[model samples]
Target: MTGTPDAPVADVRPVVRRHHGDEFIDDYEWLRDVEDPDVLALLEAENGYTEARTAHLADLRETIFGEIKARTRETDLSVPVRHGDWWYFSRTVEGLSYAIRSRCPATPGDWTPPAVEAGIEAPGEHVLLDSNVLAEGHEFFALGAFSLTDDDTLLAYSTDLTGDERYTIRFKDLRTGEELADEIPGTSGGATWSAGGTHVFYSTVDDAWRPHRVWRHRLGTPVADDVLVHEETDERFFTGIGRTQSEKFLVIGASSKITSESRLLPADDPEGEFRVVLPRSTGVEYSVEHAVVGGDDVLLLLHNDGAPDFELVAVDLEPVLTSPLASARDGRVVVAADPGMRLEDVDVFARHLFVSYRRAALTRLGVLDIEATGFGPMREVPFEEELFSCGLGANAEWDQPLIRIGVGSFVTPSSVLDLDPDTFETHLRKQAEVLGGYDPADYVQHRTWATAEDGTLVPVSVVARADTPQDGTAPALLYGYGAYEISIDPGMSVARLSLLDRGFVFAVAHVRGGGEMGRAWYDDGKMAQKRNSFTDFVAAAHHLVAEGWTSHERLVAEGGSAGGLLMGAVANLAPDAFRGVLAAVPFVDALTTILDPSMPLTVIEWDEWGDPLHDADVYAYMKSYSPYENVQERPYPAILAVTSLQDTRVSVVEPAKWVARIRATTTGDAPILLKTEMHAGHGGVSGRYDSWRERAFELAWIIDTAAGAPASTS
Candidate 1:
């Protein structure tokens, strides 16, 4: 069952693709308004809807797991290993039956893969069946990197088994591997170890699932009655858990939204009042995002005080620790030193602390020194940027254990290395077999700007050929997610090579509603000014055409989620701007989207997208440009709109409903196809290859539509 093919570009041009203006009002039958405000309200208040959705997700999870397990049966892969000591999920590969190893020791480069060769008579992978998931779901069992205490008595971990934007917290004892304490706490999980190792402070969603405070938990105590070290009552002020030396630091912010925040709270006493580390009311002075808590008065803060590139600042913790480290991850949050290194994943370890920076793409580990050192100037530790994924392990096997670094780039298979802070030594443990096939350097990057209709300049970053042809017609795919202050910076994608290899130019429009340019840029691109984003995308397309990099006939615009709204609005306003419109899980009906807050995330997302239901004025603003309701009879460009039936964030019904309307109203026969993933959430598809293959599907469609290539194997 291959996917549907894209319409050829050659067939699209000379078709007179142009913007639809008010002059076309008398051209065809206008859309009949059948929308019912009362019905939408009823659908939300009905709890039956939530139950049905939950049941549907469970079924989808089962189907996906069954399909994957069945396909890989007899593959001799090791059952995933859970390392409770230094919280990590690992799989070791020997000859056949790849052994899975987790919770590596704090000893540098001394990690032993699960094997009899470790010469230790202890419970290991061979001794433990991969039956962790065999029993009923362990709501507490977290996936990915985690940590344990020195005696392996207490364990801390996270579980996003379902990425509903929140991870549940679970504390267990390795001696029994039975969960000791579990807390959903109606919030996203952020567990951090306290200095005494008896209690853990973690961040979570509040009663309404809004980010509110960081709570504390005893090692084996009941999940009830968790202490609140720090709580932010302000709807705008949000808090989550991060790691300190012993306890989790309360990461405070203005909004839980990405790249948003102003302060942090590191509580030394999880059960006690928290002292503000970074002032939350710093107001507009600083735009603080994510932070890392280290020793004494040391803290690693990521902030853009209205600057181009975010500047990393080190703050003394003693002055900031008026309170305890309130945020939580595992048993203990390790701080990092400046000269330290991350293997490649999301972990950081150095001399004294293990640090984790959540917002920025690049992270570094630094040694901590309180008063003697004047921020020794934050230095970058060298690690292979390309072939490796580095991460840190907190609540590891030791009290002051060194960071366990996993290093290996594309050329190199995954390798384990322990980094020692005091000794400045990196020890090599084990390396996965070569099994060579892929290589890096097949990609490149370029940056440029385009001016919009209102004279607003939009920046675009392109990743394509160093030797792109001057033929001025290389098929290009321009992507942007320009809503809600999210910054789409330069990122590496392995699958992007699919289009690049086939000679397609990949570009990212750094439009408004995104922090690419700064706060002003974000402010200008949001709310009533959102039109700038759509026009910004269009201007970029026109810029490409004018620059001869790619013509409007050869250009295609793509965006997903909120960005999907951007794509649709642009396509709606300028049908002839691009060859194809690729939108995924889009919130096309913006005004209605915010108005129906009960519709999944409508209530929670009111701050991002204003609530139209609350005010008639807002509704009027929304009706001014609701994509679905605005779809009129016109010779629009070919479009591929995708959604997921299982998506709780943006329901399949939104895109489904939009596609039906678009198909019904368009003047031309341009295909308006709907591709829904029945098994995924806001994020489409799971498993790596599945994601790449899906991208391939979209790429094939875009190519055929924009370059006029043969349609995909529909």
Candidate 2:
């Protein structure tokens, strides 16, 4: 901490990659071979150097971590969700790093959940899985598939101890409290139990880490005896298996970025042959949900066949079973597509239907009563907050008259409630306990628009302390993720309060690549329009400064994964627009990663990003904006790149190579630091405390950098 520490110098072995009649030289490509001893040594050295550089901010990190912990209720229980004869819930004890899954008996006529509180259990509570116990002796732990049989007597759960997505499935007899001998390994972290409780359906990943095969495992059979029920031959499509809410049909679905296909088999006949609900069509994506409309069984389809924003249609189940090539478009139109609304999902219960969609740049939910004729009028759920996130919760029972909904905003704590089908009245279940005299009134959230260079207005959600002055003096953080049609909705975070309390304005830029507005927004930001995502982020930053929210010196940019690519591009395009950049598990070397078909997710990503390997224009376009390739000899902002060595999504070598090139090429005095979690995956360090500490470290760096103080010097 006394003097500036020398940055770790990467050994460069230039490798020339020729694609589409173009040759590009890449240094540090050898780092991609993570098994190489030299690569591991380099990563270790980088971590050591980063630790030395940020040594002075250790106390600040602790203070922020303490603030996060103090605000969050350490011991709490989630609202129990009633499935069948039991109300299932999870509990976290004080100082515990994991949650304990437990359930209690449910009364036949009583729809009300038992009054369960933290550090307490309901009557006849039976523990199903305690992740803390299973996670012992591991640096990382994640609970994957937690499913119960229709009879509620058998349980199938999966666990990942190394932070990787692959899980090992296990079974238990809830009635006898005995752990069964059945265990399935190397699965894709999901499992669906057969209605009769005799078999479980799960998916396994291929060498590329894609869930490509669906397997059915009998409870008493060996792992090797599991049947490969379905295999997705296309590399672009991933397969998933699950049961309908009615528990009447088991569904195996396969989908790519733009197209999807589903096959259904009756749950009563686990050994029966699966029939196609709809054939896969090019550029058409649809999902099927089994529903009983007026006592007649039907398949409700949410599809984007000709509708850009998607629409809802209902087809008789018998017709889909009889005709394999039946198109959802030929069925009865339940809800016509609206250009402004992007239909996401539909869940049907015995007497009602829940539809989740995004309209006016916000997620909304609507409920419709299932009348004998057809369906009742749609009743949209109302919320007072102008900017908030709301979605469906655990509504496992088809006959359950209540629907659970999770709602929250940047200033509001997360609240879970149950909506009654009879009157659309919502009953409060539980709101997150934020200790230390926290008040939502103390903070304010604003929805503003930033005009991009093309005159397109991009939405930005800003949250700050109510008393904070907006005179370009307060340090601000601009966050963005503009890829994969993922929406960065407004959700409250306890850790984020540390920044707001410290006079930092947090703004999320809803760029084009995201599905914040609609499907058109995402389409305009991906593939050929990918550059729009980065430019929109830069525009948002300029708007914040112009609007007197924060100055360039007091502003910091943050993003992860694909958003990390945005950070890198903006750094090159508008280096003076921000004070610092934090890229976590970034995809900086986009051209390199996507050009290689052998890379994990490379082929699958072609739908989002054009296949540069096969197309000349795509290669040229990606090369033009590839962050690693575009590094120039110019002043740059302070940068902190975080990655996980075990991450199968974005390889650790990307950020490693990016940091190496930036440090070598930049003329700026700012430090470019790299931190790699050796024992974790893309999620970084697992466990609540460790995750908090990791966040604390990043927040401290952001605070220091925004103050124009370099935490590290190189």
Instruction: Pick the TM-score winner.
Output: 2
**lDDT tens digits, residue span 1-714, model 2:** 358889999987999988878888998899999999999999999999999999988988998888888888888888888888899999988899999999999999788889987887778999889999999999889999998888889988999888778999999899998999998999999989887899999999988888999999988989999999999989999999988878899999999999999999989889889999889988999998888987899888999988999999888798667667557789788778999899999988998888999998899998888888777777888888899899999988888877889999999998999987677689998888789998999999999999999999999999998998889998899999999899999998998887888888999999999999899999999999999999999999999998888999999999999999999999999999999999999999999999887788888999999999889999899998989999999999999999999999999999999999999999989989999999999888888999999999999999899984332211
Whole-structure CA lDDT of model 2: 0.90
How much lDDT does candidate 1 score?
0.53
Residue 437 in model 2: lDDT? 90
lDDT of 1 by residue, 318-363 (tens): 5544543332111122233222121111222233433333222233
lDDT of each candidate versus the true structure: 0.53, 0.90
Candidate 1 weakest ten by summed lDDT: 8-17
What TM-score does candidate 1 reach?
A: 0.67
